[model samples]
Every structure is written in C-alpha cells, then in structure tokens.
Target: MRTSIVFLSALATSVMGANSTTYTLPAGFNVGLVDSSERSAWCSAQRNTCPDICQDGTRLNSCDSNTLDFSCVCADGSTPDVTPFKQTVPFFVCQANYGQCINSHPDDAEGQRTCKKNAVCGSKNATEEADSSSSSTTTAASTTLAMATSTDSTASQTSSVAAASATTSNPAVALGGDMTKYSTGFMAGLMFVAARMIL
Candidate 1:
C-alpha cells in the first residue's frame, strides 16, 4: 500500500510537467465534456471556490473534484437568454466572449476603440459611441491582480500544473491562475484513492 502511494505520487508528479492543463479524472468520473447546462446535476452542484467573473452570460464553470463537478449559471444572475448582446468572435474565445462595444467605424485604428485590434466582434458592447480599448486593458490587469492576490499557501498545496506546463528538467511551481483549484482537485483525487484502498 505504501508502495502504491509512492508510485501514484511519482506518476502524478511526472504527468504535471506537460505544457497544458488537465485534471485527474478517476475511473467512472464524468469529465463534463458536454455543454454546461447539460452537465451532470451532481457536478453542477459542485461549487467553485473562485467567484465567476464572466461579465454577463450563461457561463460554463468547472470545479475541482472535491466539489460535485461543473456548473452553468448567468454571471449576473439574470435569465440566461437575456444576454448582454454578445456575439461569437471568429477566433479568440476571450474576444468572442468578452469583447466590448463601440460606436465608431468598425476599423477605427485609434488606441481608444472598443475590443482589441485582434478581435472580430470589435464593434459590439452597449454604447454606440463610448467604447474604449482601455477598458479591456484595465479589465485584464484587474483580473491578473485578483489572481495574484488570491489566498492560497504554496506550502500547504501540491500541483500537477508544474508537470503539465514545464519541462521535466525544471519543475515549476504553480505561480498563479487556477493552482488553488487544481490543488484542491489533487487532494480530492488522493482522498478518493485512499478511500478505494480502504474499501
């Protein structure tokens, strides 16, 4: 049993070096692959430690294994269908979901336009004339600052992110972002394993 924990821990540590994100899905656990609304009710019952920052939309939120599963809810607690006049931007998910609105020409090249120069729905939002790219910059910076200021101790948590995002030569610590949730997921996965062993 001790050997099993060591092996599993080593395997988990190794897998964390990949450069992408992933959660440890135990056998028979649902992955929430479908639309957020259609996700398992039990999963939806799971709570995300972080508040949803979606400006205004029926959002698809995922939780670590410790919680039930995933969730879909309006960011502003409004009817999901009463959207904020959002459009699916062609390529970037961020731009598609979070682009601002403007009243100027669609191709206005000034630094004070709505969405970034890279967004497809660059001319949407609420106001027809008062769009500002500066808003997006401020929003992005605020989000970064929020993540940086999140309350989590590195010493108390473990991460698989380091394995998935960095090279094996140097395992990087999870600096910010979803590391808190990932750590919760990892701990939950470990608990699940231990429970199975006891059973």
Candidate 2:
C-alpha cells in the first residue's frame, strides 16, 4: 500500500510537470494566417511557407475552407496574435502577395502592381521596431515620472512599472494560470481515485 502511494505520487508529479511545459515563439516570428483563398491554395501555401519560415519546427494550426482562413506558427506553441492577418510576413514575395490581396481596388491592375511594390519595399524588421517602440514608451513614462516630486507618486509609479514588466517578461504567467488550476484539480481527483482503489 505504501509503495503504491509512492508510485502514484511520482506519476502525478511527472504528469503535472508535463502539463506545465510551455513553448514561446522565437523573436521576429508570429502566429498568423499565411493566406486566405481556396482550400487547396491556402493549405498548400501554409504547409509550404511555415516550414521555410520556421525551420526549427512548424505547426500548421488550422485551415477552414468555408471561412477561407488558414494559419500556421512555429511548433513552440505561441498564442495567436490579435489582427494576425495584418501582421507582416517574413518573406518579401509573401508580403507583396498579401498586400495585393488587401488592395482597395482589386480589379485595377496598376493599383495591384503599386501595392505589391510598396509592400516589398516597406517591409521592416518587426523585432527591431517593437523594441524601439517599447523603449520609447518607457522613456516617455520615465520622463513624466521624473517631473513628479511626490514620494507616494514615485512609489506608485515604481510598483506599476514593476508589475507591467513582470507580466511582459513572463507571458506564460497569464497563459498558464488557468492550465495550472485545471491540472491541480485533475491531479487531486486522480489521487483520490487511486487512494480509494488501494484502500
């Protein structure tokens, strides 16, 4: 009976650990729709493009024929971003094609050509852009705080900044909170069943 208890405890620990495993996307990559067209074309583009983009490992998430939606991401299991369809594509040709698809005047050949050309030329490093934007925001906030001389205000600002930084640095905290709750309940139920069987 004691040995059974020990074995069950070990099994539960392993299972819980497995449940906690989370993957984050590498820098400059995002989970987004590669294309939206016919089922065959969408699926083909997703399957072909994701591997080329995320050579480490690729996860072709979903392809909806009716909705004409298809999405893919790295195998690391990053959460899908809001407005992912509008996010920049890593490849120049894909970006240009996406621009063409979103063109206001789809039937106009000249407009389509201009849109494609602009997209290819305007493609920028997303990671660098994000870093610069965040840094600038932080600097601006710091400048505002510096103008305030109150001790209580400074303390409040410091705490708020710390909390914001914590959440941003560890995205899994928000994502895994629910998973942890579910896993705890599941493990408790399993142990209860095992104890009853052993008794």
Candidate 3:
C-alpha cells in the first residue's frame, strides 16, 4: 500500500507539471480589428496596407499616446509617412481617400476642366459652391470639421488641427475603421486542452 500511494502521487505531479506548461505565443498573438479609440490595440482590419503595424498576435509597433491608437512606426532607415496623410495640407480644403484630392466644382464650373488628369481640383470653399449634387460633399466637409472639433472648446481646436494633419498624412489613418473583428484564440485553446484531458 505504501508503494502504491507513492506511485500515484508521483504520477499526479507529473501530469500536473505537463498541464502547467505555459504556451508562449508569438508577439501580437491575437487576430482582430482594433477600435480607433483603443490606444494600445492594433488595427488589423487594414492588414494589407498596415501589415507591419500589427503583428499576427496583435503586437503593435508603437502607441499614439496622444490619440491612444496603435501606430506602426517604420523600421530603421524606413520612412513612416508612406501614406499621403503624412503630407501637410490645408485644413479647410476637401480631400478624397488618401489625399486623392476630390475635385469639388462650383455649380457654374460643371464639366469645366479645372483639374489635370489624375489631379482633383474642387471649390476652395464647400459651403459656397454646394448644390443638390454637391450636398454630400458639403456634408462630408462639415462632418470632417465637426469631428475634428468635437472635443471641448479648447481641445476642439487642437483636435481639428490633428484631423487635418492626419488627412494630409494618410487617408487610411484618418478614415478610421468601419468594422470590428474579435479573436477567440484563447477560448479555443482552452477547449482543446479540456478535450484532451477528458479523452
């Protein structure tokens, strides 16, 4: 009986040790979309464009302390402002996706060739030139301004400046995320281990 008890204890300890081994997942192990408001989270939704910015496990290059968003800082000798949003431009000026430059026209200039090929030139001021068709453009411009200044009076001005700067830097960064993704990796892993034990 003494020998049998010792054997059972040893076996239990061995089994417990095996189960206690921690799995060291790679950096950024989680795969999911990051909310713009999540300061330390990686925005995996824009993977193709910002792959290095977010590692497979959700490891981010750097966190934008100001905005509380994760940013992929360029590697050594690499430039971070590859996107057009990095380029500084006017805050009131309307722009397209990624500084593509949406050429807004006054109702009077319809069909008028104001922009060069691939170049967009729009009204200097949206409210002044907007009509039925241009209503959306006007709304977008206004929304951009409003969002940039949604904070308190003092911070509102500063936020507007940052929003404008982001637009000039990379439209993707400024456009933000439209969808959300979540990862069940940890749960799945736990289930797998539980099944193994039961079997």
Candidate 3 Cα lDDT to native = 0.36
**Native-to-model Cα distance after best TM-score fit, residue 87 in candidate 2, in Å:** 16
Q: Please give the CA lDDT of all the candidate structures.
A: 0.37, 0.49, 0.36
Clashes of 1: 12
| Candidates sorted on TM-score, descending | 2, 1, 3
Q: lDDT tens digits, residues 24-141, model 2?
A: 3222222344343534454454445444344345544444444334455556754333122223222433453455455556688887676655554333343455557778999999
Residue 53 in candidate 1, Cα distance off native in Å? 30
Between prediction 1 and prediction 3, the one with superior lDDT is 1
lDDT agreement of model 2 with the native: 0.49
Clashing pairs in 2: none
How far does residue 90 in candidate 1 sit from its true spot (Å)? Answer: 11
Task: Give the winner by TM-score.
Answer: 2
Candidate 1 accuracy as TM-score: 0.19
In terms of lDDT, the poorest run of 10 residues in model 3 is: 85-94
Candidate 1 global lDDT:
0.37
Tens digits of per-residue lDDT for model 3, 1-199: 9999999999976854443312222232222322344322222222223333211222223333223233333333232331322111111011221122222333434323433233332223222222443677788999988876774666967776776655444523433642123236744554465455434
Model 1: per-residue Cα lDDT over 1-199, one tens digit each: 9999999998865743331122233333233432444233333332221122234433334433333323334455432221222321111123322233222344665632434543433233433212344577788999888776663534223343453233322212433433445576775665565455434
Model 2 / residue 75 / CA error / Å: 2.0
